[model samples]
Target chain A: MTYQSRYAWSVLFRLFHWAFALSIVTLVVTGLYVNSPWTNTVLEGSRSFPMATMRYLHFLAGFIFASAVAVRLYLWLFGNRQEKFWDSAPITPRNIRNLFSTMAYYTYLTDRHETRLGHNALAGTVYLATIVLTLIQLVSGFYMLYPESVFWQKWGVALFETQQQARFIHHLLMWYFIIFAFFHLYIVIWNDIKSPEGLISSIFCGRKFHRSSS
Target chain B: MTRHLDKSHFEPKLSRRGFIKGCTIAAAALGLSDEMVPRLVEAAASAQKPPVLWLHFQECTGCTEALLRASHPDVGRLILDMISLDYHETVMAPSGNQAEKSFKDTLEKYSGKFICVVEGAVPTKDGGIYCKIGGRTALEIIREAAPKAAAVIAIGTCASYGGVQAASPNPTGAKGAGDVLGMPVVNIPGCPPNPIAFLGTLLHFLTFKRLPELDQIGRPLFAYGRKNHDQCERRAHFDEGRFVEQFGDSNHMKGYCLYKVGCKGPETFANCPAVRFNDVDVWPVSAGHGCVGCTEPNFWDTHSPFYERLPGVKIPGTGGIVHDVDSAGKKILGIAAAAAGIHAAVGIGKRIVKGRGKSDEDV
Candidate 1:
């Protein structure tokens, strides 16, 4: 058998990935602080505005995060076959079968893991869920940010009964992102080690290794 | 000019200057410009007093008490004079059959001309037996009277969205007046709503012959449009993170923000900080306590664990067990971490077992 290397990710896809990750990290850190500000500044009164600064950063990062999501969504619709939603996501019947097969590999029911050029069905399914969650965050975050906007209030905020409930959903979803990060890191690293593919580096560089018949 | 005014219902001490001053305040509260003050004065002096039928149900009468305590326009007296309060159970001199006769007479005589002011929730469970007045259930009375009135005003949180009585496990199945009547009503919502808001709404109605612009929840925009946090005196402190850690803390004494001590000001929509209560330049936050968020819907359930910053979230699959988001987030994260660890361990174990005897061909 010979090893073949394929260029998998577009430059925009890699940029979106890193930007999305960084924004989520900043948002989670700043969001947690905004929820409960533990840092106390020595400067009193109008001299320093810690919460205001934190909230501004959160809102700023939120916009960047939303923009990153928008880029990914655009890619899902119009990018390469590997990057497209219908091709990558486990939506079609063929992909559904691939999902069960991938699940079998993860659960140890199958010894030989099926290698795919793009995302395996299970990973794609999880990515789909994360995309959905990011959308929820964007909607809720925007609603909370612009409380007085008639459009947001009428449409976005109306979905969540109150501003507080919208805030609560946004906060709760942050935990999901955190947990996803933990599992995502572990699984990608595990796959990199277990398989011949340089799975972790593939995200940074656009290349993945696959086995070919000699 | 004021000689015919009933001495009991109109403040005798109110000079022409005071009346104009009251009208100016009314104009301001109604979100009307200075140009409208003269019109307000004219309406106050000459507009035909709209007949009002005030009903009581499952409430504390705090709304009435707050109205009575209104001093800016002497709103207590002003309301009595500006509207022919034909049947208020609290202040009406009559009782028993006479009060019933008055409610009925107003219902018949004025019909679509009279305004209905409901001050409490109506119990809908078991034939509305939780509260009764003159052998009629609150549900029955509101159902009968609301359809006939020109407009219905729900005067407190109880009447607006069922307040405390409709909190979790609401035994009486108490619902707001709008819910009972199955129609929209102008909601002036607060634990005990600022009487100025109620008076402003009434004056705006009397002046314009229509209800003021209402919010998505049918609350008059002048009073319920802006959030308490936005209008709060401690907003600067909140932005600066100068929070009171607890009651009677040094920060509390300094009148810092009450967000940390479970102030629901951020979510509560009301003009409490701006309009104030009892004619004093003070509100819950200004008086050194966090806002209870009495103005919003289902506040008792949604805003409770009042001393805490956020309401407890019911854990999924815990059969309605609720925990604050912090601890719940931690627990969920921990579980996810543990699950990931176990899954990684199993993957590692499988890989090791495979590597022991097999050629790495499967890889």
Candidate 2:
């Protein structure tokens, strides 16, 4: 029953986590609004660009989201061993075994919970997928924003061939993020409830209390 | 029944002043600098007019009809007489073997000199038997004529990207001239392209002795450079989110954006808004209809449901699992929400059964 506090998330990681989360939430809201603005209510007696303003805000949030993701990527490449990119690699035989075990635990096929200081194999794999999807979103968003720019016109046209296809992909991928966010929140909350060793607080306070094996 | 062109008889019909005016207008339309006007005039006035061989395939001859209906006085006349116009099946006063003889004679007489203006999609299925002229399939005629010409111009959507004939389940296996010729073809693609586009392209070549700059699809950049949405008069409505939800609604009458009603202007690349069709200040958008993205490749098949914003994505191998993007997205969100709700209910039930009382640590 003995418990020990261990440093987990870094200060920078915590900041990035919030920034990324906030930006993504903002982007989803504004992006959906841009796709189909819900209001025809023009400001009475005043000439204002509501849709344009929404678009600008959306674009700005997109840049912030992209930058946060970039910073996380940099940390994954150059940070401590515990935070290294390989920590999220789901391909190794050991990681694969852990992934299945984690899947089994979540599905209630197994009662044993394998305790880990970092993200479990299944979570790490999902994060990897998120990173890839974020990259696609960034590229597609920027390309659509400045399709006629010289470099993008040449390379982007070669890549996407048309703006409609790029738009379709961008819109479709937003749903993926939405679905992922739901599952992510549920898992995090469920895990914290199951093991009350500062599971949720670790992200905020950079430390987690784990039950000592002894 | 072949009719000989009496250049002397036709020369007097177009005044030097009218011809020069047409050239200037054409030069401007072609996106050439004002300085290019003199060159255009010279090109037009030159004794040796550029020969043109007009070819028709699987088409409705709408493009020719549009050209004939040019609003500017003498524009139609200039288009017809300014070029040698060696052969045009629609306008030519010849038929049967005489027409065939005229086409052959013109092709040989102006080899490596004439411009090949193809006006329709070339059918390739069943050896292009769907469309034939003078015992030759469109494929055979294009193959023979395109390579020998100094330049090739695909005058309408059909000639550019197979148009309506190439729509889904295209039985005729119709294709554009560029696909058939296996060479770059200057494409001026509209359902029935603005005749001015064709005129400008022709004038540009005649004036400069080379084709104008083109976009990825071989469409003259001047005409297809900016998107239709960019120059649309109703763009302010789009920006303000004042859209026509349906045809003939109050907003539509107020000239609101047609986006919600399936205007493809955003995706369509053309100068339709800038240079209104038939020289009138009205385009499809102005006339209260959404652009069908007629200038784009595969418009008929890809840009369908002209009243919808986004086209449905057809699932492969499925008989018909075409999903509208907006609805599909909403469904996914609904499913995710439901799943989260179910999982939360299950978790709460488990917690209640286990007697693990809710603690402040749950936050």
Candidate 3:
């Protein structure tokens, strides 16, 4: 079979993308509880399940998220230099201007697509924000998750020792993530629906179907 | 055998001794031993019939329904007969003008003597057009009745905080009696509020000639002090973070904590978990559902989705387990703060080194 390959993403990029997406879905499912809503609940046999399980799920998901971040960083350092990190995603004045342009272009509020590799400026900025926020969640989450981890316990206590304080930070971030997620999903759907190519499957199965003739 | 044969009708009513014997039997049935029966006996013998004036306003009359179904029959009947039930619209046989006339008569005869129990909120918006009785506003009824009352009690969430009707976009601008009447209305706030809580409040008022210690909201601290979270049996699950993901799911079947799905118990302060519903130890959460925080302020608004916890409150140093919204917001905001600090440190460190380089060049 004759094949054509105009590179959209590297193999490593696709792997990181899929795994990160999966972990985020898992986190969202489990995150519903991170703050909890009920009290004085009495279940006949709910003892078999416990909070530890949810935390374990959250932490396990975090590890995968962190691994995804690690792979992205490694790709930045070791992947093809021709794929310059700063070219498409940097926050320089040029990209900052492009961020608004990309948003406008996507919304059909404008029609301008800049030459890009990987994420556009707006996408890059949001992705960076996600990474940073995820890292914060991990740091605070782990500190609360494994208070006995001597390293985390010490730092957690130094920063926020009381259980109440840790809880406050954990809960507050959950809402922020929810709001971020709603908009993030909107952008994804916007791209997937508006664009001739289905954007979601591209991330999931490693192939974007395009209307443009190859 | 009859202590009060002074009247022929009093003969069949059974004397105090026989009544005490009946009380002993009833108390024994309640898990209280014969020894503890004396407390109830003493209470009954006290012959304290606290005069109660049940006033209705803009409401569904659910509080009255709850009162009829009160668990303690002795308390209920005693409150009815032993204490002069000066006026109650639903239970009182008199109706229309006569029923309202009874209220006026009581106000005149028992001026500064009766206990006024107000149900439902007073609609103060637009000249109190929301609720009208006898061509007068509920706001007017409460104002006229409250001052002369030995103790003013606002029963149910409506009378407490205007309840579901007073929720956002409140067309009538309904407010709790305390807010509308400009007085400290002892609020017994629940959806309908546990009837026993009303009885208990009345008991304290009658026994002490004053109100029980109140929370900041003027609710009885006896009923509103501890959070449903603190008293929750599933709290251990919350501490461990076990949550029910869905209804009728395996986790729910096993009785896992409902905190994850938005139980508001952790942030809502009430005795639902301890005292429970219908004089049974089963409450909303204990029934395998999450707390809706019906007893809290703006529960319909502040606490909603029935399964989600409210925002965290602030604490000193903000320990990991705080449940207040203000505190949690501050904590999350700390994320940006940490990032800013890291950036500042990096910049400062770079500037210091650059200064050293300049100084060395000068040297």
Candidate 4:
């Protein structure tokens, strides 16, 4: 494809991007207030409105995030066939080797190798792990939240009498994201400095300077 | 009728007015006021001291300590004076073999008539060798005495559920009176049970001539009827999630609930919050440490590491954590995508603003 017409993110993925970010921010702020680390007064002094609003907002944001993730999952499953979304994160040997090599290359261990059109190998595996972790967190979180509903209560809390069990799992999930964020920042900065190109703007403006295949 | 009533100028030492005034003051202090005055007066006049045999075993004399510190002077004295105490190991001037002889004699004299009040645990290990009085194990002595008594009152945690002695790896096999004696044992359990519970049960029995209704654990339903969390004054703090994180912190001093710091009050059944202790007006939680759940069964074993919370028992759509933000679980997707997109986009924004190559590393 010509440089001007190079493929980037589809409209759905771009929309999903902004929506997920907004929802995440909302959830974090609201979640902290709900089980406040500072003071339980987040909902205090409100005759009743703020607490009820936070509860509603928390659930609503979760719904939006869940829907976006679902759509993204579908896109991963059935995009284009050959070099489609499936092949982007393939478990092939070359990709696996590249994943390790990319990690090594970032640490200045060796010279860089040829790049793939889609996600690098290490990126693909992390993607799978993140997806799996998010799915578990979502299910367990929802299960714990309303464990008493005809749904969660009748058959949920019995699985774990102590809320501590779920808390441990949930806390562990947070560290994963933070670690991922650190590595992600490192790689992007390193790549942008080396290339000096507009590779970063592809998601926003739907355009990029595509390098020719050897 | 012979005029014998008119002949004697001598009256007994006590005057009627002084005694009545003393009782009225006592009844008021017990929080039972004028409306309840007639009942108290009638009860005091009609009732005799309930015959009691206070037994001691593996104990610290704490229940006795709590009872002695009773706020109402009359109630404190009433338990001692009104009742013919037949035998009490601690307060009775008699000791050793002489005391032993008195206990046996009283058991015979008041068999099936006196209330058997047990104050401590009975070590059943190796036939109760852990604790002894008068050269006989508390177990052997109690087993012989229990069946003949009219009613058995297990007065403290030690006698109620073996107290601290029955904590994990209980080497002596300390057992409560209920388990050791086949008789009906009414448990007034606490590390040292509130004195009012003991007095209330005793007085109720004297009036009714029957044991009060007890829960499965032999605790009187009237006193240990509800979980401490249900009636605790700081309970709203618990439900609101405003917790005191440390000792002497502002929240602790402000009277916040101790549930966050491992107060087992929510799960424990007792009225300690209402009845209080030693009439000091503040208990352990008020002192900033959480409730150790001294009254509940297996309290020592089940509720340990006293500062950490009991795994929060989520009630589903009720009191529960709202999200997966413990570490970073909740924002997984956004982070993954945003890191990818933001850093990429930040690269572009830098290039447009700074005109490319002269700019800083995207790193």
Candidate 5:
């Protein structure tokens, strides 16, 4: 057997991927703490803002997560053909067929997944949905920051009707990310082992291994 | 009928100083400049007081009690001098047929000119038979009067968003006045709303001849403009992360933030912190109890399990099965993890068996 190492991900794509993942992790950790503070650092006559600190970190990471999402969306529109959204995401009829085939492969109805360098159609669609969820989380978060501000009041607070409603939506989505992270890790690791492509390393090194001949 | 002697009987006996002081407080509450005090005084002294027909439905009269309890500038004098209380069910001197006649006369006299203040939830279920006053359902009464009034004010949470009566399993199908009337009504939503908030709204209407600026929920922005957390006296404690762990702990004595013990201040938008109830510098948070978030719409349902950080989500179609969000989230994640583990084990096992068979063929 012979294999070829091909450049699969753009440098910017890799950067956005890592930034998004890191920030999402940071956000979930800090957000959970903010939702229900587990630590009570009440020293005698002492003052510390663990909740405030967690919130500040959460907000800071939220901005980074939003910006990373923006970069990914921009790359989807204008990037190397492989990095473009359509390369993996099933938008057209042919791609939709590929998506079902990929699902069949995952469900063990088929022994083979279609050969693709980037995300399989199902993964791509899930990522697209994730971007949408991230946007909702951002809107909900930003609205709560300045509930009194005219801009947010009109767009965020009023739209949600109450700050708690927005908070609930935001909190609900946090669990989604947690569940997503679990499935995401398991599947990606499975791919790294089972698939011919250097799946996991491709994210870090921007290269994938493909069988040249066997 | 003997001709009523002493026209002064109709006039409120307010001392000029107290009247001026009251005007100042009103101006402040209305977010008007100090210069607006004289204008407020002038508005109050003007002979043409707006006729207010206050209606009570499924309520405890707490809003009225709070209003009457205002001591500074004497809210009793303010209410009497500023607006002609045409037909408050609780405070009216007349009763039975006389009271009914007064309400009828006010409706006739002040058609399209009066302020209709509704103080409780209106029931619409079963032909609106849940709450009745003088043989008319609250729904019937509000519908008859609200459209005719210049403006409608839904005082207290009950009138604003159906309060406790409209909470889940709302057997009577209680709804707010605005919902019942199907028109915009100014909502002053608190369990027992601060008199200052109501006074501000009243004074704004009297002085400017228009309702004050209202938020999306139809609450006066001057009062419901900021969240209770923002103006909280113990805000420093919140920022500093000092919270009351329990009701009687030392932290409580230190006046720490009540966020930990389920203070809904962070979500509640009310001026309770800034304008304490009863003309004293004391609100629920100030008195060492966390805010119950009485002002926000649907507070009874949304802000309940009130002593907790978050409301328990009632699982739909589960026949009243309620679980805390955090616990439910953890359980969901745990289930996902276990499923993922099982899937991985199956996938890995299949791969090992397939690989062994393929390697034996190569050997």
Candidate 6:
């Protein structure tokens, strides 16, 4: 069996990916602490605002995460074919069929599997959904952060109606990301181990090994 | 009725000195500059007393009680004298036909000149039959009166956000005054909103001849400008994470932050801490109880289970099985872990089977 090394991801895509991941991880940790600070460490004589500091960090990371996601969205719309928006389109009949086949392979109901570059149909669908969820998180977060601001008070309150609802949605979606991360990590590792694709390394090096022969 | 009585002759129950002192204190409480003290006093003493028609609907009359229990001994009298207080069902000596006559007379006497103070939620279900005043539904009376008034103030959580009456399965379809009147209304929302907030708003309006600045919910910004947590006395404890685990525990006795025991101060926007209730140095948190978030909309339904850190999310159509954030998160995480474990097992099994098949072919 012969294999070809192909360029799969852009440098910008890798940078954004890592930045988004780091920011999200930091956000989740600090966000949870902000919600219910379980730590009781009192740095006596320091007079530092621990909760406030955590909140500021959370907000800072939130901005970074939002910007990275926005860049990723822009790249999706106008980047090269390998990184274009259509790569994640899961609406076509062929894509739907491919999704079911992919599910079957995962479930061990199929022996043979289709070969593809970039994301498979199911992964594409999940990524699209993730983009939507990230957008929701960003809107809700900014709304809660500046509920008193005139712009948010006028528009965000109209859309979300209350800060409590926005907080609820934001917190709930954090769990979704957590669960998604678990499966995402497992699948990437499993694919790398099961195939000669270097799936995990591809994210870092922007290159993947693909079978040259049909 | 001495309708044209001068400020000196008004409300003998409140002496001029007491009224002036109260006005100065109220001016300070309202976040007005010290220079505004004279203006507040002048506004209070003005002969053209703005008529206030206080309306009652589906309510507990707690707001009126709170006002009566104001810290200043003469505050009630001062408020009554400052505003004409043409009609209030709770305090008025008249009842039955006489009260109705008084309300009607006042409405006619001060048409487009009076301030409308609504103290309860307005029911819209079943022709607003839930609350009736003088054989007239709340909706009907508000519709007839609200448009005629120069300014309308909803003076409690009930009047602001439908309060407890508009909780889940709200049978009467109760709504806030703003929603029912289809106009912006100044809302001073609390289970029993601080009397100073009401007084401050009314005084600002009287002094400026315009409504004070309001938030999105039409609450005066001076009083409802900051979060309760922002101004909480125990916020330092919150920052240090010294939380009360349970009511009457050691932490509670130590006067730590009540966040763990379900204090809604962090999310609730109010000035309860800055201006303690009854002008005494005591509010809910200071009195060793978590804030129930009485000022926010639909608080009764949304900010309940007062002992929990966060309100439970009710899954729609689940017949009220509420899941708190942690539990729901844990469930998802548990499922994800289980799924990952099972997948790992399946992947290992597949790999072994493929390896054996390859070895057999090689043999």
Candidate 1 per-residue C-alpha lDDT over B135-163 given as tens digits, one digit per residue, 9 for 90 to 100: 87888899999999999999999999998
Q: Rank the candidates by DockQ, best first.
A: 1, 5, 6, 2, 4, 3
DockQ of every predicted complex: 0.54, 0.38, 0.07, 0.09, 0.46, 0.43
Query: Residues A1-214, candidate 4, lDDT per residue (tens digit)?
Result: 2233366566776676667667666766775544444455434444544444675787788788778677667767755332244454546776677777877755444444444445566667777777777776666566556533335433333443223444445545545645565665567566656544355665576444555542
Q: What is the lDDT of residue A134 in candidate 1?
A: 92
Best by DockQ: 1
Model 4 accuracy (lDDT, Cα)? 0.66
Write model 5 residue lDDT over B63-169, tens digit each, in one string: 98888756453665777677999899888899999999999999999899999999999988999998888888888888899999999999999999999899988
C-alpha RMSD of candidate 4? 13.0
**Which has the better lDDT: candidate 1, or candidate 3?**
1
DockQ of candidate 3 (2 decimals)? 0.07
Give interface RMSD, per candidate.
Answer: 2.2, 4.5, 15.7, 9.4, 3.8, 4.2
For model 3, the interface Cα RMSD in angstroms equals 15.7
**What TM-score do all the candidates reach, one by one?**
0.94, 0.88, 0.54, 0.54, 0.93, 0.91
Query: How close to the true structure is residue B105 of candidate 3, measured as C-alpha lDDT?
Result: 91
**Arranged by lDDT, best first:** 1, 5, 6, 2, 3, 4
Once fitted onto the true fold, the runs of candidate 2 whose alpha carbons sit more than 4 angstroms away are A1-4, A42-45, A197-199, A210-214, B1-12, B106-109, B313-318, B321-323, B344-363
Residue A6 alpha-carbon offset, candidate 2, angstroms:
3.6
Using DockQ as the yardstick, the better of models 1 and 4 is: 1
List candidate 1 segments past 4 Å from native: B1-15, B316-320, B356-363
Better of 2 and 5 by DockQ: 5
- Give candidate 2's error at residue B22 in angstroms: 1.8
DockQ category of candidate 6: acceptable
Candidate 5 lDDT tens digits, A52-110:
78889988998888899889989999989787888877797767988898887676555
What is candidate 6's TM-score for chain B alone? 0.91
The parts of candidate 3 lying over 4 Å away from their true place are A1-33, A36-214, B1-48, B310-363
Clashing residue pairs, candidate 6?
Answer: none
Look at candidate 3 and tell me the lDDT of residue B3.
26
